[model samples]
Target: MIRGVLALIPDEFRRFTPRYLALVVLLALSQAAAYLLSVPVLQALFDGNYGDAWRWTSWLAVAVAATAVFGYLQSMVGLRIGVGMLRSVQTRLGDHLSTLPLGWFGTTGSGAISRIIVGNVREILGVFSHLLSPVLNAVLVPIVVAVGILFVDWRVSVAMLISLPLLLVVNRLANVGYSRSNQRIHDAASEANSRVVEFAQAQPVLRAFGATGAGNKALDGALRRQQKASTDAVFASVPGLMVFALCVHAVFLLLVYVVIGRATGGDLSIASAIALIAVSSRFIEPLNQAAQLSNALRSAGSAAQRINTFLAERELAEATAPVQLSEPSIVFDDVAFGYSEDEPLITGASFEVSAGTTTAIVGPSGSGKTTLLRLASRYYDVDSGSISVGGHDVRQQPSETLLGQVSLVFQDVYLFNQTIEENVRLGRPDATADEVRRAGEMARVDEIVERLPDGWATVVGEGGASLSGGERQRISIARALLKDAPIVLLDEATSALDPHSEAVVVRGIHELTRDKTVVVVAHRLSTIAHADQILFVDAGRIVERGTHDELLEQGGRYAAFWGERSRATGWHLAPSTYRSDLNGALGG
Candidate 1:
């Protein structure tokens, strides 16, 4: 864990590692000089040499001032290093996370990632900036003082050194127990945070069900567990910490006894004994500080391990030499993939989407329809076969190159907490105001924007909470339209819209996909009646493939789906049928 923490220190700061070490050495020297300077001052006063006492006092003041200056510099340098490393690490982690597979995000909740990125990262800052110098001083200053005492009286110094091993044993015992408790506390805190975020996000649903109180049980339970864990951690470590404190105090007592014994035996002078007592008092301070810092180091070690694990997560390997796409078409040749190795979401999936054509995929909820679109977009790599876009394998092309070729509009739309215009502009960051306005007009998002009090400048709130589902969908469509990639993937893009809004969005999609390769996954059978090709997917395979009308004529899976959808589309509640059912139920 200490190694992991050290690894997080950026190389830029590491270049000054020698300077930091030198500072620590200087700090220890300054501390020892201040302590040692007291020796001559005490001896002159005891000898009644007023002139020599004044001279020693002057030197002692200078040593004290120098120590203060060095301490200040150490703090300034540590702060600068800590803040700089924090910024660099956060930025690097954010960039690296973007390159990881989307499946990783799904499996690891946002709450867990945010806790590491925001909370644990700050813990690292404490480890590097605030903790490092003090820990170094604690170790180095004591050794320097011990060496000085050795010259004063070797036997007394030997006794002091013996206490060093005792300090180590107690600290080790305390740290081992504290580390286990600290880990439990950290896990409990993370779980509590995750539950709070989940509850907050689901508040509207809970209220609608009139079960908000009941729904809070999980979050409340998590909080209780966190409280209990925290208490347990403190209690579990207190005994060992008490023992450690007792050991440290005992060492101080031993040092005092040794100093008195040496002075009485005539081996040490009165002034020398007095100086040793003063130095001994200062010496045990560093040992106590070392014991206190042990707990912080253990917590930091745990935090560092988590951060290292996140940093070590695997990313999709980019091609060393990327291949260029020859066309806008997409092809899947015996593609197979799964979130886990044992459960495949897609298998033996083979299909070809020709350039400037529309292909629609339809299936049941867990039939891998959306997964197919995700695979085509390279959100996840295939396990068994290759997925090629524009005659080049997607894995053979760079992510940037592949992403530039396709625009995806998923069923679930997320908008940043920014202006409607800025959200749309994300589709093409360099796009001009006029281009944004044009895309909005095409997607009919302009209608919604105009209704807002701030128009295009309005804040959308987190995830566009202020807007209706269909409004958010139109904005998403506008974004995709502005991107204008040659290949478009749509997953229930119009599912949230009313008939009129759906018609407008459909028109926008049609305009955007004109002369482009399009792959769509839709549950509404009516929406894809005019698709150039329709694939009926079931249980990770395309069970049927043909044009919509052709599939309907075959009377297979697609035909059955169509029949159910058509009946549902025309059916409505009848008063006479409802009355008959009510009477039957009542036996009237």
Candidate 2:
């Protein structure tokens, strides 16, 4: 686990490795000097050599001061390395995520992904910056002190060494329990984060329904579970830790007894006995520190594993030799697809849209209208058959190449938390100010922007929460216009707008789709009355297709849909009392 985390440290951080090693060596040497100084100082004092004892103490103080300087340098360097790696990894991960298919984001919830990127990465950083030095010192200082003790008296050293294996065994048992509990705690934390994000995002809807309290059940349960897991982790490991401490104390007592017995029998000098006893305390202190750090190590291990797993996720394969498109037309030939393999949402569907024509796809909810558009856009690969744009199979071209020729505007509009102008400019980052304004005017975005206090400079809140749905839709259209791609895909782009806003947006859509090969998954049948072609999708198939008037004249499924929609436009609610009186009069 430690090795896996170290591997994440990029090559740029290796420059600080030597500095850290130097700090560890200096710490161990200083510790040995401090314990070893006690022997000569005590011997000199017993012989009334006060001057010699003072000199030895002064030298030990110097070593300690030097160790402090080295420790400070190590801290600064480690911090730089840790923070640098954190930022680098985050940037790289974000870039990689952007290249992944939209399906990956949908499968991994935003809350879970955020927790991994922000929370788990921070934990891993703590492991590198704060935990590493203490861990290394704990291991290295003990070895240095143990060797120093051996030169004083091998028998006492042997007794001290005997307790190490027992302490290690107890620590191992404690770590096993700690690891299991820590994993549960980590999982619970991720779940709690997800619930918190969900609750926050749904707050407006929950309040409207007067069910905020009821809606909090999931988040509350997750928090309670996390608290219990934390408590259980402590309870599970504390007993083993206590046992380890007791074993260390027992060894300390045994060493003290052996030294005292040897001194009393005149086999050991008084100075040597006292020095060995003093050094024994130092030796065991590192062991205790190492034992306490076991839990932190376990947590870091789990976090690192998650990060590595995410980084290792597969990405969509790009063609080695990508094919270039010769036209703007789209052809779906016997295409089949599903979120899951066994449950196909689109099967054996074939269609063609010539360049510079408008084709509207109308269907009931969940009839695969959006799925078909998504496939055409290469958001997901088709399961069986080909989806070609401009005579080139989407899979035969690089995703970037295929995407560059298409502009997508969907019902759900997403805007970054940036100035309105900047959001629109995302379609073409290098677009001139004049070009942006022109596109915005064409898409009717300038009308909405002009109403804001800052006009184009106004910062939209996250996901454009500050803007109304229609306003956001206009901005999205503006972006599509600015890109000026040959093929435009619309998925009920005006479905969320009010009647007034829909009229303004429809004008913008005309400008965007003019002379462009367009495929619209339309919700409003009336809007597409003049469409060159209308494909009535049902149960994953194009059950009917013709011009708008031709389908209505055929008096089939499309005709029925048109009839129902036409009546729905004039439907109205009447007062119950008035309706009943009218009915009674008619009966009389």
In order of appearance, the predictions have TM-scores of 0.95, 0.91
Off by over 4 Å in 2: 51-55, 213-215, 319-323, 549-556, 575-588
What lDDT is reached at residue 564 by model 2? 86
Cα TM-score of candidate 1? 0.95
Q: Which residue pairs in model 2 clash with each other?
A: none
Best by TM-score: 1
In the range 184-286, model 1's lDDT, one tens digit per residue, is: 8877888888988778767787788765665577788988999999899788778888888888888888988989998999988999899888888888887
For candidate 2, the per-residue lDDT at 155 reads: 82
lDDT of 2 by residue, 228-302 (tens): 999999998888788788887887888789989999999888877777777778778878888788778768878
Task: Give every collision pair in model 1.
Answer: none
Q: Give me the overall lDDT of model 2.
A: 0.83
